[model samples]
Target: MTAMPPSSPDEPLQPQRFFAVVPAAGVGKRMGADRPKQYLVLRGRTLIEHTLERLCGFTPIERVIVALAAEDPYREGIAILNSSRVLCCEGGAERCHTVHSALNSLAGIAADSDWVLVHDVARPCVRVEDLQRLLDRLQGHPVGGLLGVPVWDTMKRTASDDQVIGTVDRQHLWRAYTPQMFRYGVLRDALSAVLARGELVTDEAAAIEAAGLKPLLVEGAQDNIKVTRPEDLALAEFYMAQQEAGQS
Candidate 1:
């Protein structure tokens, strides 16, 4: 695997100003877990802690802001957070709502021109180099961008009866990944439009696309999968070890 380029803190890159909003409010019912996925232990730290460490380590990111559930038990995570540079805010009932709350915490609040990266707390495997690439690509774009992997495997269109209805044209199909980057004001308006239409967006990219803005997709690492099931934690742990080994 090709390694991500190391970003130097002393030589901080200009042009890209990154402010991430990580949403970790969803109860992982599918995982059949007792706690939220972000709070789950991975490699001696909470998954979120690992994510924040990397995000803050990158020089381009101005700040790391997390949107957590209102009733999240904090004492266990407090000291870990105190050791890092991330700021925390209360999340709302829905994903978009939480993002709105988190963005409100931004002092100046981004003008329509500023950029915001909406990342998934569960997607802890997002690589700094890949993120940097996406940031670089977004600088000149008319709208913004998202990190995604091309569809390499044949896709199936399933029917209600669990039978394959037809084969999908997988040539240009790809799964969207978070750290979905976008212009702050455009995203805000897009999200507002989604709310107005009473539609549920699986990710911020949907909202941006709904606003008639094109978000370019950058090729992302395939290992950067969102953690959902218990087994996924094991895979994420292995990926983490691979990352540390690479850095070493």
Candidate 2:
């Protein structure tokens, strides 16, 4: 990866024309894997490698910057992925913080209007069709967007004591997934606001919301599940197989 000259803080931010940011620093405790879920083997390669493989296929994306855990325990994973045009950065304790760290690495090159699609590295089955779906939807809107699937299963709510409370109204519910697309400086400002308010957000869109901007939710697949647990690995493998077979 070539070093990007930092942008001048005082200069007007230019519209971004290239690049994507990926956050891959989680410890993967829920995955029950000794290695980070992103580095875990999938279909013959690590999950992150597969994720980058899909992203690298997109001609619109010029470069990919991965936000990883400091000390980067997955040396083999890194070496395998090094051939791709992807750079690495250290992540923070929290998910959004990791994205912020990746954004900071952009220096002056990232502009408020330039697009940055922040995705979860653990999810290796992200489809090119789904990404195209998002780009098409965002092209018609001012604010950027992300991938989301509507709730299709039965809903349930639990009580504090672990008793069944009632069925949650699933009417307006939608499952949030990556890649959450947005502009660079816009996201930076939104994150800064969240930090100042001492509030936490579950995703980049939430921060964008606090900034009074509404990001478009392009329909995505439920098949794009985050590999957070051991059982999920199998499901992810199946999903990825379908994707590979062009079943998506």
Candidate 3:
């Protein structure tokens, strides 16, 4: 992949459009549901629907791409799948593969310097304000970053035997959140290289880090949570209500 040329200090940077890629291929085994967690209902809508609506609602995001399993039976039923602003592609077995597939799908349409924000479909409480904040802060940054909350709870390290190893320092530690942003070319190259080496990357930030680049950390609301367990669905509903009330 060809890298975008760096802009000189004297030259004004060109404007880059924004795009969103949501990886929704996972079965979410931890949720223990009959179907993927994203296919489950939340406030009368599927989790994937909420996620797609939230991302599509953000005005700055020109397009939203979703990567889904090849045989995902529920996708065609969602009306949003037919929307012009959203596109769907065949996803892989893993999150990294799904993301890479989405990125590849955008190759002809998105410019190398354009920004792509990778978010989780399980995170329905992500606020538009936070999304704007992240884009605002990292617009011209060399390496884009993600929205995260600072760790506030006391932490501990554990041994394989389930014994407490030691009290861990929480200083400078942040709980990573979604909408991790990076340039199209940079992210594609980073993910490609990392996956090629058979490395495991939990998020886009880790992939960027593996490419030897420091991604910026933009502070965001702690309520922007990913729904994993059944209890998390209720909490996400509460947060979503709060966000809606605030918006009203």
Candidate 4:
């Protein structure tokens, strides 16, 4: 939970640059769609397109690196992938592997102190205000954090037989969401260590935690939902419309 020291008034302060990474290698079997879920049409554009636009349009971020399946065919059709600010690389099978691959691609370009925000391609409704909030809150932090929301639903625990085992405590419980921000060196080393142990972390924050650091979870809009399954498409569409209408 350490933060960087404040610079002296007489000395010039060098701000760390922000970079974004996206892992779009998943086929999203749960979506039951013809193509990969990221390529699915949303508001007349692919989900990946919307996501990239959001990240690329953000003023703080300098470049966005997207890791796609080695044989991905849909990327070329999306014009945004050709943007000079967007870099593409071959991805691995799993989410962690894909993210690690993107990090490897960033080597020699991204400095150790640079900020890297890893976001999900399925989350097209992520708000810019949340991204700014994460940066504002985590500025100069030694170990970065992510955008999340407190879980307000009733707790439920089920057994293999579908019987309720017990009701878990909900206090201080939160749902982990994407755009998990961390220092380039810390994240890369943490992921490398986890990968060396053959451990699969579902998110960047987990890898940071495994490295013996706590990631701050900044409260974010609940509308930043991950689009999964057939029903999620409609839900995402609704959220997007709300966002555009200034209602979200």
Clashes of each: 0, 2, 0, 0
The C-alpha stretches of model 1 lying farther than 4 A from their native spots are 1-16, 80-84
Clashing pairs in model 1, backbone N/Cα/C closer than 3 A? none
For model 1, where is the 10-residue window of minimal lDDT? Answer: 1-10
Instruction: Give stretches of model 3 more than 4 Å off.
Output: 1-6
lDDT of 4 by residue, 139-244 (tens): 8788799999998999999999999999989999999998999998889999999999999999999999898888899999999999998899899999999989
Model 2: how far residue 205 lies from native, Å: 1.0
Candidate 3, poorest ten consecutive residues by summed lDDT: 1-10
Task: Score each candidate by Cα lDDT.
Answer: 0.78, 0.79, 0.91, 0.92
23-106 in candidate 2: lDDT tens per residue?
888888887778788878877888888888888888788678888888886755356357556877888888888888888888
Compare candidates 1 and 4 on lDDT and give the better one. Answer: 4
Model 2 lDDT, full chain set: 0.79
Alpha carbon lDDT at 162, candidate 1: 85
lDDT of 1 by residue, 1-248 (tens): 11112345676664546688888777778888777878888888888887777777778777777888876884254464564457778887788888877777765855555678888888888899898999888775657889999998989999899899999999989899988887777777777778777887878888877876678899988889889889999999889888879941
- RMSD in Å for all candidates: 6.5, 5.8, 1.8, 1.9
